[model samples]
Target chain A: MSLDQSFVGRTYPPTAPYQVGREKIREFASAIGATDPAHHDPEAARALGHPDVVAPPTFPVVLTMAASRQLIEDPALGIDYSRVVHGDQRFAYTRPVVAGDELICVNTVEDITSRGGHEFLTTRTDVTTTAGEPVVAVWSKLVVRGEA
Target chain B: MELPTQTFQVTRADLVRYAGASGDFNPIHYSDRFATKVGLPGVIAHGMFTMALVGRAVTTWAGAPDAVVDYGVRFTRPVVVPDDDTGTEIVVSAVVREVTETGLTRLDITATCQGDKVLSQARATVRTAG
Candidate 1:
């Protein structure tokens, strides 16, 4: 199904708060093979001026990607999950995500276009703390391949 | 200025770990049968996993753990990982495109697997250590 251009600029409600945990950060760091001391030891992170273990730069995807499901599953959007492929991703951080922070996401449909028998949809997710502090902005583009 | 190149080994074990960590359990990244049925060469690495590795290169270059201010990439190609102990490798290299007086360093990044570019139009802006 073709994406409806009218959905561009549509914004979804803020997602439920996700509490960042030290073990989660450690697991993610380990998965990516990031050996930074700050990602594992709280003492090491505190020495580096962080209150707790610091998450790797790309760790926000754990939150944003799930939050984006609201948009992709929107009946009006009519996104066919089977035909979708990740096209691009971007992250702009105001500060590194730290363990013990509660983060929320607001998803917005930034743009939509069709090309070469495919439809491309870009969504921007603004991540912030529950207290209204901006943390990171994430953008993701999905390409839906047309059926032959 | 050109930064030193960094290489990362991506094994199937790594994919399993990343899938658990990132909550992306797409069978194409693990099940060869599913990947083949879906028209992929084989089990492929997650695009975000590659980007995370590249982020490591950026932060390592900045000499700080949390120095990245902005980063982006387009998935131009996939990094296919054959099921094996040795797995595959991704080489990440970057050149300083510009350094602003305000302490921002802009870099043009390239990430390749088997000498073919996997990420295109990749770039990062990082805050240099004082």
Candidate 2:
């Protein structure tokens, strides 16, 4: 079944605040083999003017992915998780993500299109600190393949 | 001018670690059975994993971990990782597209696995720190 085009431009409610942990940033950096000192050592990050360990550019995917569940699991949207493949991803930052910052995300359906028998759903997630400081805007396009 | 190339090795173990860290436990990334059932060649690295590697390369080139202000990529192909000791490799190369008066350096990046492009339209903007 094709996705409802009406979902486009729909913005979901803001997610609960998620505390960005220093160790989680370290773990994420280590997993990707990003050995930058600013990613793991608070002192190094401080040396560079960040308050604490700074997350790498793609780190917000951790939060936004969890936040996006609101759209993927929306019974009305009817996204077939098993048939979905990531099509595109992008992030534009207002500032680098740092540890100890409590973050929240609001996901919005940006676009929906069908091509070659597949539905492409583009979602944009606006990430901000609990205090309403904008952190980054993340966009992800997922392709829901049509059953053969 | 072209920037120095960065290389990263991807293994099944790396995928497992990434899945745990990113909270994206999609079976297609770690389970060969589920991957094949889903019509994939075999267990594949998460697209975000590859994107993170490319982000590392970008940050390395920028000389600061927090330099990146904007980054984007299209997943053009799967980076298949067979169960092995010496897994696959992703080679990242980039060119400086522009440097603005405000100290932002824009880059056009390319990421390849086994000489095949895995990401397309990859680009990043970094704050040029003194």
Candidate 3:
């Protein structure tokens, strides 16, 4: 099944808040082998002007990826999860995510196209605090391979 | 200007750790049987995991952990990981493509796994430390 082009430009409701935890950030950093003290130590992050341990730039994926489930699971979208492959990803940050921030994601379909027996869907997710402070904008492109 | 290259080791353990951390439990990144059933050679590394490593390279070059203002990448090839302890290696390198007057540095990044390009059009805009 192909992605619905009509869904392009449609913005979904904001997701439930996700609390950014210091231990989660530290675990993510450790998984990536990032040894930056600010990612692990609240003191180091505070020294760098952050209120608590700061997350790596890619940490937002943990939120946006899950948030995109809203779109991927939409019956109108008709996405075949088994055939979907991640094509591209991007993140633009106003500031690094610090521990304790309650973040929400609003996903919007940016584009949908078909080519070479594949359907491509691009979604942009705006991440913000519950107080409406924008934290980051994330874009992800998923390619659904046509049935063989 | 060319930035110093950074290489990251991607082991099966690392992928498992990343999968748990990122909440992406895709079997293609862990179970060889599932991956092969789905037409992959074997268990593969998560594309986001590779991007995370590249992000590490970018922030390290900028000399600040939180310097990246923007980052993006297109996955070109999967980094296939064997079941061995030494899964694979991704080498990340970048060149300063441009510098803005407002202290932003645009970088063109390249990430390779076993001499094959895994990511294309990888780039980052960073706020350089003044």
Candidate 4:
């Protein structure tokens, strides 16, 4: 089934503030084997001008994925979680996220289209500081595969 | 010019670690049964995991942890990670696409697993360390 076309361009309310933690950044960096000192050593990050430990480029997904649950589990939108596969991901950064940042996500449904019995839904997440500093914009494409 | 290639190994263990760290508890990354039930060949690595590996390569090339200003990728294929020790390998290769007057460097990236390109349209813009 195709996604609700009316949902396109619908923007959701901002999420609660998510505190970016030092330990969490370390864990994320280690999980991917990113051994750059700036990801773990606050002093190293400070030398680079970041306020605290710097997160990897894809780290925002950690929070944005959780924030996007608002749409995926929307009873009205009715997305099948089991049949979903990721299609594309993009991140444009105004600045790299650091450990001390308090981030919030605003999710918007950018587009929805169906082709070849598959439905594609693109969601753009605008991540910012609680103080409204734009951090980065993340875009994700989820494909819902049709049963044969 | 092509940057030096980097190779990273992905195992079910790495996926589990990533899942816990990223809060993505998708069964497809850990349970082969659920993966095949959903018509997948086997437990697959998370798309984000693969992207993170590529990000590591980008930063390594730029010599800075916070170098990436922009990054993007299209998941064209799954990296089936086995439960064994040497599960799978992702090879990342990139070429310098352009250097802007503003000092930003753009790279066209490629990630392959088992000889199949797993990510397409992969690219990154990084502020290289002077």
Candidate 5:
């Protein structure tokens, strides 16, 4: 089934504030097998001029991916999750994530296109601090395989 | 304006292990025949896996094992991994580019496979102690 074209350009509400914690960052790093000190030790981060532990550059994926659920689960969108495969992802950052930041993400369905038995959905997630500081914007594309 | 980088190869086994660990069992990453059938030159690494590696390079360089405040990436190109004894090598790198008055540090980052930019125009930020 094709995605609802009307949903294109629709923006969802900002997510609840997510506190960037030292432990969460550490867990994500460990989950990804990242063995970086800056992602685990505050002292090590501070020594490198950080106020506390810093998250890896891709940390915003957690926030954005969560925010994007609004689109995937939108009843009006008519997306078939079972047929979807991640086509691509990219992040444009204004800054690196750090512990002690309260961040929020706003999700938008940027575009939806269909071609040759495939549906392409593009979503964008904007990450910001509670104070409205821009952190990064994540754009992801998902391709839905043809119905067998 | 930035610290030196730590470079290393990310092998095919590493990609396979990452796929198992991440629960992203996409055949294009493991099955070479499936990968070739899909028109990719050969088996390719997951873009997220490479993105995770870039995150590793930045956090490790900052000296904090956990200090990432914000990070994002775009998959401009795919990393093709040919079945060979040495496998494909992905080199992740980053350098401090700017410092803001709010004590935020921005780093320009990249993840390359065989010198071709797989992830491009990447950036990340961290807060510094005043």
Candidate 6:
């Protein structure tokens, strides 16, 4: 089934503010096997000029991916969550994320295409502070595998 | 004070184990033929798996298990894992970029395979205990 092309440019409402926390950063880092002091130690991070412990680059996945539910669950979009497989991901950042930041995500469906009996969905999520400061933009590609 | 970097060889066993743990079963990551057919030089590791290694490097330094709050990366290139004698070696590195008032720290990160930067412009945010 083809996706609703009309949704390609639709922008969803801003998500509830997500407070970035320190321990959560540590957990994400540990889960991915990151062993960098800057991810947890204030002194070490301070040495590098950061205001607080920094998160691993992949940390946005924890929230943006979760926010994807808004689009995936939308019946009008016709996305089949069960058939979906992550195809690729990319991030563009104006600055690194830090704890104490109040973030809200705005999701947009960038494109929809079909090839080889498979559907491809591309979504972009923008993370920003409540004051409208842009932090990062994440683009994700999902492929819905065909049933043979 | 100093950037953290580590290099280690990845084995087929490591890839298989990560696949099981992460629940990602892309044939190109495990099947040589599938990988070759898909135009990869050989089976390649999952980008997230490599990213996971970067996270591990950070957590090891943080000394805590659950401190990461924000993380993001751009996949500049794919890590092509060849079916050869030497396997693959991945190097992970990070630098402290900034500190925040609420005890949050930010880092610049990178993931390289051999000499190529498979992932670039990576950054993360972690919080400290109050």
CA shift of B59, model 4, Å: 0.7
How accurately is candidate 2 docked according to DockQ? 0.95
lDDT of 4 at A38: 91
Q: Candidates' DockQ values? A: 0.90, 0.95, 0.92, 0.95, 0.29, 0.16
i-RMS of candidate 4: 0.5
Report the C-alpha lDDT of model 5 over A1-148, residue by residue, as the tens digit: 6788998888898889989888877776666777657778888788777788877666677777667678778878988876766677766667668899999999888988988899999988888999999977888888877875
lDDT of 1 at A128: 99
Model 6, residue A148: what's the lDDT? Answer: 50
Which scores better on DockQ, 2 or 6? 2
lDDT of each: 0.94, 0.95, 0.95, 0.94, 0.76, 0.75
Return the TM-score for each candidate structure.
Answer: 0.98, 0.99, 0.99, 0.98, 0.64, 0.62
Model 1, range A51-147, lDDT digits (tens) per residue?
9999999999999989988987897998998888899999999899999999999999999999999999999999999999999999999999999
Measured over all alpha carbons after superposition, the RMSD of each candidate to the real structure, in angstroms, is 0.8, 0.7, 0.7, 0.8, 5.5, 8.2
lDDT of candidate 3 over A1-148, digit per residue (tens): 7778899899999999999999999999999989999999999999999999999999999999899999878999899999999999999999999999999999999999999999999999999999999999999999999999
Rank candidates by lDDT, best first. Answer: 2, 3, 1, 4, 5, 6
What docking grade applies to model 2?
Answer: high
- Which residue ranges in model 2 land beyond 4 Å of their true spot? none
Let me know the TM-score candidate 2 reaches against the reference structure.
0.99
The CA lDDT at B127 in model 6 is 68
Weakest ten-residue segment in model 5 chain A by summed lDDT: A27-36
lDDT of prediction 5: 0.76
CAPRI level of candidate 5:
acceptable
lDDT of candidate model 6 versus the reference: 0.75
